[model samples]
Target: MSLIPKSHPRAKSLLIREKLVLGFEQGLVAREGLLAHGRGEAFDYLLGEKTNKAAKQAIKAAAAQILLAKLPIISINGNIAALCPKEIINLAKISGAKVEVNLFYANEKRKKNIIKILKKNGANEILGINPNFSTTLSGLDSARRIVDKNGIFAADVVIVPLEDGDRTMALRKAGKIVITFDLNPLSRTSQTANITIIDNVIRAVELLSITCKKLSKNNKNTLEKIVKNFNNKKNLSDNIIEIRNNLTRRSRFA
Candidate 1:
């Protein structure tokens, strides 16, 4: 029942792109989300569509942060809802984090549609609809600023996939432990996050879920070490070096 062939070389990634397109037509994704997905796709191609070692370490660190947080919230946008509804739900369940819809192009109609989609995907208590239960994030001036008072606003740790730079900075300013998935290692979102997984959202979330499940059984000290040892700036720099090396080698061969 999948849109693309399972045997296709780029099947998983193509399916992700196709889903975003479908989400746009269904009003679950915005035009900006489509363009953002395309941008991520180009980076994914450079990443070889595989999770690198550093990304895996970052994923483990992210899982540790979530497991250690008193209140962890997974912030989902339209593109995330359209592409990885089930994966988000599963990550939330495994990490004991709450699922909340936080979109940049905020609107009641699209919000409701996204809520319905999340519910259908097994999310029971979706947040982000109650205007009464909202708080303003001071550093951001975009539609992404309004967050549920009990969700992102109150969370000790937050997982923000496909995040914007402003919100990532604002969230950190608000004193929340931020975990982000960004293909571009040099992006502000990636650089600002406490633990930045430089990989595709689909691959990152699944690995994160697995890591969380495994780490859940480990001692608190062990989890704490994982978080303490993660250096977001260094990780980003290393990935950028890898990208440059790849390009350099390709040019020399050509």
Candidate 2:
């Protein structure tokens, strides 16, 4: 029944592209989002579309941060919503965090459509669409500057999957604990995040959701310990080494 056959050589990659195209057609993703998805797919291919050990560790750290925060908010954009709406909603429910729609490409209609998609996927409460509820993340002039007063602005911890660099820096400057999913470990968003999972957003969110659910029964002390022991810089370095090793192995064969 699927348009992309399961037996195709590039089935996984093609499916990912198809999802982004569908997202754009459904008004759940921005036009620029297709381009971003392509960029991420390139890295995903290099990484073999597998969650590396370092990325798994980062996911654990992100889960711990979510469990440890007094008020955690999951920041959603069009790409994220389109790709993993149900996963995001499930993670919020498991972690007891709020869901807020925050798009870098700001548009009222797109925002509303994203919210509708999330709601359909079981997001009971969504924020970040009210003009009256707007607040600025200081030292940024992008569309990401606008945030909800009670969403990203008020939360002590925030999860930003498929994030932009400028907003990642601004969130850290605002003194919020930031977690991000970025394919490029060398990217600004990865470097700026308090915890960066160097994996595709789909795998990152799925792993984060599972980890959060597993840690749900654990106490705050356990969660805090996990967060305290995570090393962001080392994780980034490990991912870089992974990519290099893969390339070296390929070059030797060639």
Candidate 3:
């Protein structure tokens, strides 16, 4: 049972921290990931800890992009695995995207642990584990460069939730459409992505899955239109404005 009461003002945030702490204890999260989450949490606070209109727009565009893609892959890491494994699987199922584990702090044990949790959450074919099938993504020297031959390497669209800037740029350079979830609209990952959902991943993943299901019935032309009308730069700019507006509102009550 969660020690955090739902009535607590910061209950959700506290629970997220608890999960990451447990994930670290389980060998599913790196120490670096914990620090990363703290950074994102600060940005989350700036956004009023809620999904904004701009993020919803980006999610819709992202769903359309995923549906239109010939090959879509959702990249997973320790933080994502710890936070929302089931949501990731559902998004893949709804969007026809493959699930692949790619980590910055890659290791066999952690990979197995992430895969194990994913499988437990209903994922059937998790990739990026076997070295024999791993192919190097040019322009990246981190362990994240090693991608499954049949997954991110060959995918046309990739949903990298909580991604790093270098790999996002590398994927874009390799002629792939990159979609990512980031709290900070100014981050390179947010700017480099073809579609950027500026919201908490725990909320964004579920919202994306729901959006994909709703958009699945739309015609190809409609989906293409949604994708075409979206401008990542503008969407990110709107998010920054939302943060500024939110901070201004909070200051009034202070």
TM-score of 1: 0.95
TM-score of each: 0.95, 0.96, 0.98
Question: Per the 3 Å backbone cut-off, how many clashing residue pairs does candidate 3 have?
Answer: 0
Q: Can you rank all candidates by TM-score, best first?
A: 3, 2, 1
- Prediction 3 TM-score vs. true: 0.98
Between prediction 1 and prediction 3, which has the larger TM-score? 3
What is the Å distance of residue 131 in model 2 from its true position? 2.2
lDDT (10s digit) by residue, model 3, range 1-254: 25898999889999999999999999999999999999999999999999989999999999999999999999999999999999999999989999999999988999899999999999999888878998999999998999999999999999999999999999999999999999989999998999999999999999999999999999999999999999999999999999889889999999
In angstroms, the error of model 2 at 194 is 0.7
Predicted candidate 2 versus true structure: per-residue lDDT over 122-202, tens digit per residue: 998898877899988888988788888989999999998898898888889989999998999889999999999989888
Off by more than 4 A, model 2: none
Ranking by lDDT: 3, 1, 2
lDDT of 1 by residue, 217-249 (tens): 999999999889988888898788778877787
Show the lowest summed lDDT stretch of 10 residues, model 2. Answer: 12-21
> Model 1 misses residue 179 by how many Å?
0.4
Tell me the spans in candidate 1 whose CA falls farther than 4 Å from its real position: 1-3
What's the lDDT of the predicted structure labeled candidate 1?
0.89
